[model samples]
Target chain A: MKIADVETPALLIDLDRAEANMKRAQDYADAHDLPLRPHIKTHRLPRFAKAQITLGARGITCQKLGEAEVMADAGIADILVTYNILGTAKLDRLADLHARIRIAVVADNAPVIEGYQARFDDPDHPLGVMVECDTGAGRNGVQTPEEALVLARMIDAAPGLRFLGLMTYPPRDDRVGARLAGMKEAIEADGIAVREISSGGSPGLYSAHETAGITEYRPGTYIYSDRMQVAAGLGTLEDCALSVLATVVSRPTAERAVLDAGSKALAADLSALPGHGHVMGHPDAVLTGLSEEHAVVDISACKDFPAIGEKVRIVPNHACVVTNLFDSARMIRGSGVEETVRIAARGCSQ
Target chain B: MKIADVETPALLIDLDRAEANMKRAQDYADAHDLPLRPHIKTHRLPRFAKAQITLGARGITCQKLGEAEVMADAGIADILVTYNILGTAKLDRLADLHARIRIAVVADNAPVIEGYQARFDDPDHPLGVMVECDTGAGRNGVQTPEEALVLARMIDAAPGLRFLGLMTYPPRDDRVGARLAGMKEAIEADGIAVREISSGGSPGLYSAHETAGITEYRPGTYIYSDRMQVAAGLGTLEDCALSVLATVVSRPTAERAVLDAGSKALAADLSALPGHGHVMGHPDAVLTGLSEEHAVVDISACKDFPAIGEKVRIVPNHACVVTNLFDSARMIRGSGVEETVRIAARGCSQ
Candidate 1:
């Protein structure tokens, strides 16, 4: 069915564009001789994850254990959960996922290491544990190389855990490779065998080859580049595949029009961009305000503002958060909706 | 089951507090002898909607046709959908709900009224249509009372529609009541009987009795008061009934710790507030940054900071958007997870 026939405030995915985005990122990783492990947080669809694997990704990366479980149900053999799985309930599920597939996880703190070591007891089939290094992104990771070595030794000494190389959500600092390389050397010198250094960020994926230490890269948002990616200079606006198909419900004035898609659909994530999203074809339309179900668009810059009942497409600021808001998405192949795809792991933030 | 056993990044609803909050709003409305119609957008639960009605609410208000349909399925008799229902798909669903129970929808434009008129063709059971007026909210509404009357005449002229009265998402302007009061007189002077002047806002629900024109008041977030409401001086911190129960996943530094709940859970609506949310008991803690799954918190103001693996409850900036993020919410009665209730209309933005 045409997107027009579908309900308003619905998520529209341009599949051809997404597939091309996938191939582009995968090709870039392939050219750099880095195995691409696309994060499933962007689309949250098992079909897209499988497609990425088909396009030569070594495996898939999930941010949460719940997401990994969903990917595993789709018969994905290799998975990497990029989170510190703590608490009894989560660790119990982590053990279940570990028993079935070739999986790995990352941790930066001692408590997380202790939790992982306590869960997995079989020394023969040791679980791969990567020491998350901060590098420069002041989010989650060890601060220094010495701290990385400390965590590396903790994992290597554990009977059930093997020390995998460093993992970093590389900071904006271009010297991230040098930092990880230095940390890897320190950890290896301290008697832990470093295996693979994994680093990722969609904004700096093209420069993967320049980063010396990392063996593989995980780029999640590459499948559906959003306005955030465009602002970060990662991809052009045409590369964005997902857009909220919303109808202009109210045009109160020539300078202002309200769309049905709001914070609930578009997400209120202002990830480095000025507004909530970018309205396609209306470069001048600024989404100045977003109530729960209404996106108030500033149409003063547009010579001819859209009228009520007209459908407009909006590319959200952050694609990953947008994926978590909806239950399903309409796949647009060529010009029309091919099928409706369930966001099987939509709210898998556990 | 204990709440600690429940997974992190879960939406928590304190049933006892929510019930008290409901009674408080209902009592205030009862004292003023005004009909109270609590908007279901905040909770999206028919059980709670029924509870509000049980406590002497006129009916429940909804923001979408899908939400009204969900409420109707749960035996809710009356619902006021505060949105301009446009397009064929939505109008079809609106008609389906109108056929089942008492449902009224608002419109600010001619296209929406035309859509309603074309679908609803029975004057004997004419659909209730409120002319949404833009007093000062600058969102979805007719520009002036003149525009409101024009839309009111359109609704009155339609054989299948009846002009209910004036409707306003009562803007912050104190003269909103006077503006709408004037609109009511002008429309009535033109021979169209104004039945109900529906006005709503969570922040100003307590002062609703002070307003002149509104015959009924609709307060949504008061049932599950949030940080935004608290900031707007609507209620105290103890009055907030809903919060995102998240885990402290990473304590990267002494001054900074990260929670599992980010924009996906807490929402990014900085509604007259400084941070993403208010970390209960940690008034000094500021939510500095929000990635998709990580909320970077600044805890420099605390004497004793939280550690990794610890759970913390956070009241989001906006409760309505947070409700839409989760598939289900854990109902906390006293100190535990009483049960999980499906957010029946969570993603029902259509």
Candidate 2:
């Protein structure tokens, strides 16, 4: 189906472009001799995860157990949940999942590792635990190399938990490579051989390849480069494969136009991005504000603004969270709708 | 279930409090003799929609056709979609839904109405068409009384379209009364009667009683007051029954703690609120930043912040969009987890 045939405010994914994006990342990993574990949080569609694996991805990384469960149900055996599974409710589910699949989880605290140890003791399947070292994003993970070793030692000594390796998400700094090398040295001094040093970031994808001691990479939004990615000089508009197809519901003035898609369609993630989102084809128009059901587009910068009822594609600021906003996306191939892929794991954030 | 037994990053709804909130809105509408058409965009849960109708809501008002379709499937016959339905795909779907149930849709542009008229030239059911007049939101609606009259005349002349009345969502200004009066005078000049003049806003719920021409009031977030409603001084902390139950995953420093819920769960809507979301019971703490799976809380103001692994409830800035982010929300009656209500309509925008 053509763009006009499809519903407005719908998600459109170009499969050809998506597969090409998948191959580009895979080829880069192959050339670097690094294991590519594409994060499924970007698409949250099992089909996309399968496509990544089919394109030679080693495995997949899930941020939550709920997301991992969806991938696991689709017969993805090797999964690494790059998050701290906190409570018994989640730990129990993780242990059950571990019995059927090769499951690994990351932790920065001893209590979290101890909780995993207690649940996996004398279990049917052993659990792989990775020590999360903060190279300095300041979200989760151990702060220093000394703190990383302390958590690594605790995991190595704990029953039912096998110490896999070190994992870190370094801050946007120039010394990330040095910090990763230091953390790796600290772990080796504790008599723990680091097999998989998972490092990630779309902005630091190239730097992560150059960084020493990083064996695996997990980057989610590399497939669909967004406004933030473009602004950071990471990717171009041509790299953006997914966009929100919205119609101009109201043209309040020549300067302002309202689209049917709002915060619910295009999420409110302005993390490292310059603006809310980029209006495709209208490079000058800025999505200045958004309500629940209306997006305020300032077209004063553009020589010709779109009239009311005209359709426009929007490249959201952040593609990962934007994927969670829609239930399904229309897969487009050669300017027509091919297949509608269900975002099966869209809101499985338990 | 006790608070400790519940899962982390789950949506919690207090049934007792929800019922009370529903009753309060119904009682206010009854006392004022106004038709309470509760907007279902807030919860998007059929159970809550049914509860609203049972508690004396005249009908439900949905913002999208996808939402209206869900309500129709749940046996909600009387429904009003307060959105301009554009395109043949959406218009065809709207006609199909109108045939299946008692439905009405509002329009502000001639092209949208023309599309609706072309698709349903001889509709199976009379399509209730409300002329959307812009009160002051500057979103989707006609700007002046002349525009409203022109659209109203067009609706009257169009086949298979029943002219319902006027609908407008005013700004935060308390001048909704004067704006509705202007639309009323214009409609009377054209020798047309408005059967239903619907005026809506949770902030303007009280002031709507002072408006003369408004026969129906549609307020979506009255049942669950979010950070926006609380910041608007429309509701208190006690009135907010729905919250994102998240666990503290990391204590990065004495000043910052990262929770499991982030933009994915809490949503990125910073609409008219001081911060991303309000942490329940921690008035001083503010959600400063959000990554995909991490909600960075700046609890530096709190003398004794909760330790890592502790659970905290977050009343998101925008409750409507937050509801759209979850697959299902946990229903809690009194002090126990009653059941899980499926958010079936979520992500059904296509």
Q: Pick the candidate with the highest DockQ.
A: 1
Tens digits of per-residue lDDT for model 1 on B241-343?
A: 9999999988877888988887778877876688889898898999988887889998988877678999889989889888988889999987789999999
Instruction: Write model 2 residue lDDT over A1-350, tens digit each, in one string.
Output: 79767777888887777787788888888888888888988889888888889888888999999999999999998999999888788888998898888989999887788789888875335689998877777778888888888888887887678888888877778777788778778989778877788988777775567787688999888887777777777768888888999989887566888898888888877665656788888989988877777898888889887787888899998888888887789998867898888888987776
Instruction: Please report how far candidate 1 places residue B316 from its true position, in Å.
Output: 1.4
Candidate 2: which stretches are off by over 4 Å? A122-126, A272-275, A305-307, B120-125
lDDT of each: 0.88, 0.83
Supply candidate 2's per-residue lDDT for A157.
80
Off by over 4 Å in 1: none
Worst 10 residues of 1 chain A by lDDT: A267-276
Alpha-carbon shift of residue B217 in model 2 (angstroms): 0.9
Tens digits of per-residue lDDT, candidate 1, A1-350, equal 88777788889899989999999988888787899998999989999999999999999999989899999999998999888888888988988888999999999899999999998879988888898888888888888888899899899889999888888898778788788888888988887778899988898888877887678899989889999788888879999999998998888998899999988888777755778899988988999988888899999989776788888899998888888888889999866899998999988888
